[model samples]
Target: MSFNIALSGLNAAQKDLDVTSNNIANVNTVGFKESRAEFVDVYAASLLASGKTKVGDGVLTADVAQQFSQGSIQFTNNALDLAVTGNGFFATVPELGSLETSYTRAGQFKLNADNFVVNSQGGHLLGFPVNPDGSSASVSLSTAEPIRIPTASGAPTKTSEVDVRMNLPAGDSYIAGAPGNFDPDDPLTFNNSTSVTIFDSLGDSHVMTYFFVKDDPNTNPNEWMLFAAVDGKPINLVDDSTVPPSATGIIGGNVSGPLQPTGGVGGARLTFNASGDFISQIPTLADGGIITEDFTNHLPNGADILQRVQIDFNLDPTGPNPNEPTQFASNFEVTALNQDGLAVGRLTGIDIGTDGLVRATYSNGTSQPLSRIAMVNFANEQGLTQIGNTGWKESIVSGEALAGEAGSGTFGTINSSALEQSNVNLTTELIDLISAQRNFQANSRALEVDNQLNQTILQIR
Candidate 1:
């Protein structure tokens, strides 16, 4: 009976040591959960011939239960590196040989040679696929699928309207010989300019320049005029400001200051030609201090305003700003464009969000969401059986898998450029190992003593 007890201790100790060694070995392994060897004691049972108590004997290996505690998070620069903050696991279907869905907590992923997002084993991360319009669809991937970034987002259209915001100083004086050396006649020339590269309906690029000219060199502080030109062609300004060109009359402002002197700051209206070039019409009094320029004056000046040219994609084949728009409720407006827009662009890069949303940005002023990441969870996590390579297989005990997006329900947020390390703890394992070693040594001593006693009895006999 004593020998049997010693043997049981020996077996249990060896198993415990094996568990500790395994934990220590996988300390560096990502997503590895340490396991514990459990033992059950057996009691002797005596059969009752007449009326006797029954007892069972010895101890045995009961189970090796894995600890599912989360590992400490480590930061990796790669955006594809992912980590689970809370619960749930990453699902990957093996690509080599037989196909089987495996679950893992490890999120060390990289883009494959084929440009497909994949893990070390080439298994693709599954998620909801997206359409060109940045909408998602229900789908799953067996491996990381190749991402598609459009070369040219779309063809350019006509320029409808523009918005600008800027600061123009009214510090300069209107009278030259005056105390401030004010010279309202010579308005400030607009040299501070920006260009936007816009594509024509024919897919041709045209640079547009917007010039801001301040007319009120003195009094009406914030008054300024605007000028627009495309490829150096004046498009919106008038030919002459003094004389009326057509029935539209003179678009210049009424004369304000002295008769012979060039128009002073106050009465200036903005005017431009067909090519978008602009000029300001200043009003000067004809000796009688009479207001000359009126509604016919087109070069209207106002407060210092920042100007911007924006492109409105009118998908509607119908006329501009159609009453009822297509696809989009109205029309997608891309504004605050310089010259025209970013140089004729191509798709350049892609990124994934914590919620598993994929976005693609283009060299042009265009961007779209590509997809959403999908996460799966199991009911019985402990029931999951290991399939090597830090992957797990679903067993009858694990129940069915529940799928959803990150931050939804029990799913954890996806951390970009990070990976989850193994949950194995060396500290606890070392302590457990010492206890197991002592038990093994004591069992050995007991077995040796038992054998010595048996030998003495034999010798005496």
Candidate 2:
């Protein structure tokens, strides 16, 4: 009985030493939680054996509980490194497409060869799918999936619509020096001109310029000729309205005033009232008030942009409005110039918000919402089972994992470019190590004394 009691004391002390040593060894491990060895006094009681006092047999090793306190955060240059400030853990999978989930506090992550976000152990990071507006689609653990970054170049989109708003100077001489003769080469031929860049199906860009030729003021006071060109080639707005808007001359000078479009060339007539308000156009706007800028064979790169690039002056056909382009007596100014077109862009960088939304920015001045970093919390964090690699698995003691977006409800906010260090305290671990060693030595002496007394008893017999 004495031997058994002494043996149990040694084992308990050894367990304490082992636990302390492990804590000290992993002091620098990221996301490592320090553990403490608990012990209980052992004793066997027999009914009616002792009425006054009973002695405890020895110490028995009990549970080793892990401490789940917050760790210090270390900022890094990598944007993928993440840290949680308050509560929650990052969930991951052992491999891509594998549902076997694991939770972790280590945020040392990077993009793999396939552009997938993974940890040092190659476990893929899981996240919730996001909408285009950067909102999480679902916060269920079952809906979580491995996050994959898109590194490939983004496809280009054609210039389908364009909005133009400007003021046609009413103070400028409609017929300055000579009758209006539309000519892109000579600035004197047109009063004002503006150019816009449009993209083709192949992602190539071409300059589409609009030339406004103020008509002879005396004969037609509020009239002008509208001509368009693409890449220095005249695009007939009428006949070539569909394809190959090939034309030699759009409009020529009429010394007597009025409007005269050169033969084989097409031009739209702009009419306005004396109040400088827009009244109508020669060939009124089509069904949707769209001016089809056709450049069929004019495009050298073989882009069939026939009636594809439509222009909207942003004018209200219902009645005269202040927002519409006006012949105001002021300097020519383009108030609004917008186009819905995109060029093939390369991935520039990534940004992760505090809410765990991950978005990718491109060189084309465009951003896309990728995913929301999934945050998970367990009811009993101390009850988790350690599976190495600074990761934990849900055990029976720990409640089911609760999935939610970061900064939502009880979930902690995600800190990007930061890492959570180990929670172990070296000073405390070292002190515990010394105490356990002394306990082991003292237990050995007790066993030695018990052995000596037994030896004396044998000698006397």
Candidate 3:
């Protein structure tokens, strides 16, 4: 009986040493949790046995429990590396469509060959689908799916409207050429010119130029002629035969000649008051300050696009404080220029928000939400069964996982470009190692004493 008790003590001490050694070994491991060995003393007793002098039998290994305390965070250069600040685990799947889920605190993640976010072991990071407005669509565990970032964003949209605001120099002399001598190609014919790049339906770019010519200052000091052209093709505004002919074609009005079929509304006649303040724009200043023009025959791709392009000034012509083209003494300058058209975009980078929303940025300066990472918590965290790779599986002892987004309710916030270090304390584990070693030594001495006593008894008999 003494031998058996001493052997049991030896075994318990060995188990304790094993647990302490494991904790010390994984002190530098990411997301590693420390474990402890618990023991209970055994005693032989029956229902009618006397309770006064019951002797203990031996020690038993009760259980090996894991400690799930918070780990220190280490920041890294990798954007996909994630860390949780509080209670929660990152849910992941083995494959794209696999429903079998695993929970982990290890967040060393990277993009696979197919651009799917996965860990070093190829486990896919699961996330909730996000709406167009960057909000999570659902929080159900069943609805969580692997996160996949798109290589591109929305399709190209042709330019429909362009808004421009500028100030024209007021003190500048009239253009050298009169109305009849005005020519788009001759720099001396116009006082100032500005060009803008516009996109077609096929994502092709074209240069649209605007030329401002001061009218005959002797006869019309307050009048100015605006000439428009696209890709060197002059856009006619009026039907005056008095104007010089363009190399592309003869200039005509919106109602007659070659310009009529192109939906040209003719050039604008800007009129300013004596105080250099804008009084009105010619062609009756159409609704929304748009100048409609047709480019059906000028498209490079030959595809029929929305030929009618509306040039919007964004200033309300009827408003009391309308900001129109001003004729100031300052040099000619363009204040703002914006268009609604966009070209095909290439994926540039990705950003992860604190709320676990993943957004993808494009080369075209556009961004969109890709997915929202899913966070899960168990009712009994200690009941989780370790499945290696620093991950855990839900067991019957652990209640169902409660799914939620990061920073929602009791869920924790996600830290991007960081990793959660092991929770094991090397100092404490070293101390435990010493205690277990002493216990083992004491047990071995007891066994040696028991063997010597038995031998002495046999010799005496």
Candidate 4:
């Protein structure tokens, strides 16, 4: 009986030593949790046995429980390295199409050849589908899917309109040849010129230049002629025969006849007030607007039909508006230029927000949500079974996983570009190791004493 008791004590001490050694070994491991060996003393007691002097039988290992304390976070250069600050685990699937789920705190992830996010073990990280606005589409665990990032966006779209707000110098002199001699190639033909690149239906770029030539200062002191051309090809606004030039050979000199309209064979005219404030636009379109222009055969190979672009002067004759262009005496400058067109862009980088939404950025300065990482919390973390690779499996003792978005409810915020280090404390493990070694030594001495007593009794007999 003494030998059995000593042997049981030895076994229990060995188990304790094993747990401590494991904790010390994984001290530097990422997402590693320390474990403790729990023991219970055994005693032989029955209904018929007297309780006055019942001797203990031995010691037995009850459970080897894992500690789920928070681990220190180490920041890394990799964006995919993630760390949780509170209670939650990163759910992953061992196989691509498997329904079985495994929970892990190890967030060292990378994109595979297929662009799917996976861990070192090739386990696919599960995440909730996200809407275009980066919001979670659903919160159920069953709806979670593997996150796959797109390498590029779809085809490009042609630019239909360009909104520009700029100030044209109010004190500039008129062109050398007036309106009839206005040419894009000659700098003296136009006072100020601005160019913008526009994309066609085939995603080809074309330079559209706008020439601002001051009108005859003697007759129209506050008027300016606007000429537009694509690749130096003048856009014909109207037939020159209908509205002939004035006696002075200038288009804006006459205020009557077919040339009465500000825009005819010449470019659109901009009229300003004496105080350098924009007053009105001439050559109004059929819709009573002077801000739009229609250009035919704009592309080199007729890649697209008529290219209609709206030149937004940003003038709102209504109340107070700061975006409107003013005729300030300052040098000609373009304040803002924007166009609604896109080109084929390659994937540049990825960003993971605090809400666990993974957004991929493209070279075209556009970002789209790829997926939202799913965070899961178990009712009983200790009840989870270890499945190696620092991962855990839900057992009967551990209730169903509660799925939710990161930073929502009790779930913790995700720290991107970081990794959660092992929770094991080296100092504490070393102390526990010493205690277990002492216990083993004491148990071995007891066994030696028992063997000596049995040998002495046999020799005396």
Clash tally, candidates in order: 57, 0, 3, 0
- Point out the higher-scoring one by lDDT: 1 or 3: 3
> Each model's C-alpha lDDT?
0.57, 0.80, 0.79, 0.80
lDDT of 4 by residue, 1-461 (tens): 99999999999999999999999999998999999999999987999998888889999999999999999999999999999989999999977889999999999999999989999999999999988888899999999999987865645567776776778898787765577677678787678888888777766777877778788988888888777777776554332333332122233434342233233334667777787776666554332233223444456666555455656665556533566566788999988777777665578899998889999887766778889999999999999999999999999898899999999999999999999999998998999999999999999999999999999999994
Q: Model 4, residue 369: displacement in angstroms?
A: 1.3
Model 1 misplaced regions, further than 4 Å: 44-56, 96-99, 131-136, 139-161, 164-195, 201-204, 210-229, 233-349
lDDT of 2 by residue, 272-386 (tens): 7888787776555553234543555566677654535666665566779765677878898988778888888899999998999999988888889999999999999989999
| TM-score for each model | 0.63, 0.85, 0.87, 0.87
lDDT of 4 at 131: 85
Write candidate 1's Cα lDDT for 265-304 as tens digits.
2222332222222212233212101122222232233311
Candidate 3 — worst ten consecutive residues by lDDT sum?
256-265
TM-score of 1: 0.63
Report the error of model 4 at residue 56, Å: 2.2
Clashing pairs in 4: none
lDDT tens digits, residues 1-461, model 3?
99999999999999999999988888988988899999999988999998897889899999899988999999999889999989899999999889889999999999999989999899999999989999989989899989998765555667777777777888778755555566678888778888888777766778888777778778888777777787877754432232222223333442543222222225666777777666666544335343445564477687443354556555455542444667778899888767777776778888999899999887767788989999999998889999999999999888899999999899899999999999998888889999999999999999999999999999994
Between candidates 1 and 2, the TM-score winner: 2
Off by over 4 Å in 3: 176-182, 216-221, 235-251, 254-265, 282-287, 302-304, 317-323
